[model samples]
Target: MSIKGLAAKIFAKRIRKRIDTWANNPIKTQQKVFKDLLHTARDTAFGKDHCFKDIKNHKDFVKQVPIRDYEQLRPYVDRVVDGEPDILWPGKPLYFAKTSGTTSGVKYIPLTKASMPTHIKAARNAILCYIAESGKTAFVDGKMIFLQGSPELIEKNGVHVGRLSGIVAHYVPKYLQKNRMPSFETNSIDDWEKKVDAIVEETVDEDMTIISGIPPWVQMYFEKLQHKTGKQIGKLFKNFELFIYGGVNFEPYRVTFEKLIGRKVAGIELYPASEGFFAFQDKQNEKGMLLQLDSGMFYEFVKADTFFDEHPKRLTISDVEVGVNYVMLISSNAGLWAYNIGDTVQFTNTDPYRVVVSGRIKHFISAFGEHVIGKEVEQALKEGAEATGAMIKEFTVAPQINPEASELPYHEWFIEFQEEPLHIENLALQIDNSLRKQNSYYDDLIVGHILRTLKITTVPANGFNEYMKSVGKLGGQNKLPRLSNDRKIADVLTAMTTT
Candidate 1:
């Protein structure tokens, strides 16, 4: 190995040691560290000189610190953008990570110097944990490709600034940054399409090993790469090892990716948003573990069912139960307190705090009294695909409301099959049966024949891509909506469904 490679290995070893020490330490000690961090964050958000003095008493601290959300912090975020010192923190923030928010078109989440360590440490620990679980020391040291949004940071003078990815690019070990692929630094998200096209054109012949990004965007990149090269990406990139994905589920797209890549790529779940890196896939790769940044913010979980209800059960990190679905509520250093971000997840095990993302709270289907989650839909689809000897490249489940009667609601399955299955009808029946078996409410509703019908819409070879592109989302991270409960979904199905 070269001198640089040896040094890289040594550095990785030291980082790994730090992570192991942190992970093995007692939970109580960790919790105390986390609590102290949260208090510090609170002081920074509220005026430090004034707030810091009053926060010495625990009861007084909790009472004085008001719950906050993005809307509440918009003014502070604006101030950060204006380069005002000592607003949220002592110094100017490094840069803002732009994230998609519900009301705000794009929310620029501030990351102060004090808080950047949490993000970096969480990300590093995630990787180290994965290495520890796998018992693999050497990952193929090749180019690491992060399939991300345009790194361009918006400037104060109305001119766009540096790409946040590029800013992160600088922080990465200098050697790795030097060897990393060039980032797309366009001003508009719309321009990303052409930029991605350009990347595909230039990198067709290059060897890429580690790939990271949202699965939908990665899938889109691979599809384009295949189209341009006229050969599967597996043949083009010989040394590809790890596949890191975040922002969505990877189970749905696994088969397609495995086939295209010709290797079983390790899936690393990253829990990063514009806010900061919250958690990441554990070393075991079985589930994602929350990198408890107790210091960064206090964490809370609300039962998924409580979202629409007036009084919902909210659990602190100490109160979380294994296997129960909950929506994450974060009180972060960036000024979000008791905030609901909408994504739903469940803990598989709590000893080490491993969890799997279940679905989005808003994405659940409630038709004929049967509440079906995205995971259940995915499970049914997987079973159906297995039984019918069919490969489902992409799919969606939408409810169809009867025009004559507002009370009547049925389901329509939109599928993109890899090959024409011999018995498509049988496949649809199997999917419906699986759904009925998995969810008792669905079974009861179907038995009553209230939501009786299951209509299948088989699309052309590359129909899913066309659909995603039409919606202005063409990539690995953007999934075809698996469960659409919205009433307009029925109209969309009516127009699109052929049989």
Candidate 2:
């Protein structure tokens, strides 16, 4: 091993021990975080508004602060944007991570000095955990590329504002400066395809060992590189050993990615959002990411089934159970209190509090009370692809509430396949059966003759890419929704379909 690799191994050992201490005592670690966040923000405007001083425990907190999404919290966020001090956190924010919102247009999530380091540290620790567990540090000595948004920032109320990935680019550690690929100039290119082309040109011959990004964007980068070099990614970068991804499930893309790279490489899944760095896959053999209890965020969980009720019970870490779907809430040092980030997660392992993201609370199909979720669709597609040796590029599902004349309505699946299955009809049946097994409500609807088995609509090659590009969200942390109740996305896909 090189000097850097040896140093990384030693450093990783220390990080592993530190992580273990908190992971082993999750409840205590979270309680400490809860107390710290309350104490630190007690003097802020939000704290005063919410009667934070009188709040002593989790139950008191739930009573004091109601869960609010971005639109509901925009009043305080607007004040902060207008240069108000201590409106959310203490004083001014270090940065405002700008992200596109569904109904609220653009949202600026605050990043305080106290909360910013948690994001950086959590990302670093994820890699360290992998290094320590796998006893593999050689990747630390080679080139690493994180395909992300531009690093350019604009001033907003004296605070730097940009996409979270772009904002993070400013904090790349001094050690990795030499090994991180894709020059800042190249990264700054606004057009994604052009930026990716520039990245391909720069790193096609580099010793790339780690590539990190959302799966779809990274897939685009891989496709571009393959087109340019006429070689599989594994052959082009023989040293590439790891892929780090977040924002979307990676299972459905696994077969397609393996085919593109011509080999299987280790992967690390991260559960990060604009709100906070929540979790990361720690062990190669584990099924879920380790929840970060000691971070500057206190977490709460409400059963997803009851999340829409007038008063849903919020449970703390000690109260959560394995295998239950829960909507996650947070009260963090960044000034977000009882904030619903819209993610639904299931506890896979309670010993260390490991969780797998189940779906988005808002992104699901309950048009006919079937209530199918993102995880079910992704898993079903993954199983179908595996059974038929099909390589799938991307897919989405929407309810077909209205159909032509005498036919029963069914779920419509829009799929872009990298390699077509020999039996297309069999693939659809298998996927439908898999979904039926996972979601009993959907199965009951099928049995009651309220709905028919799902039908597949094959999308032309690069169809999903074109759709994203047309919507002006072709890259930079944008994820295609796996399930939608409305026909907004489905209508667009249908029009693009020739058949």
Best candidate, lDDT: 2
Q: List the pairs of residues colliding in candidate 2.
A: none
**Candidate 1: global Cα-lDDT?**
0.66
Q: What is the C-alpha RMSD of each candidate to the true structure, in Å?
A: 3.9, 0.9
lDDT (tens digit, per residue) of candidate 1 on 1-499: 6665555456567766765564455366346654564555554544563364555543444455443466776787677677666566555666676655445766666666666677666665666655555654345357777765555455753323443444454466565664456443421344556766766765676678777777766776888898787777777887776788777767767777877787676767877665556677766445555555443655667788775676565666567888788888775565555566666888876666767777877787886668898888888877877777777677778777663556556777888776546888888898899999988998888888787747687766667666667656665234566777865544544455453
| Candidate with maximal TM-score | 2
* Per-residue lDDT over 106-168 for candidate 2, one digit per residue giving the tens place of the 0 to 100 score: 999999999899999999999999999999998998999998888999998799999999999
Residue 7 miss distance in model 2 (angstroms) = 0.9
TM-score of 2: 0.99
lDDT of each: 0.66, 0.92
Off by over 4 Å in 2: none
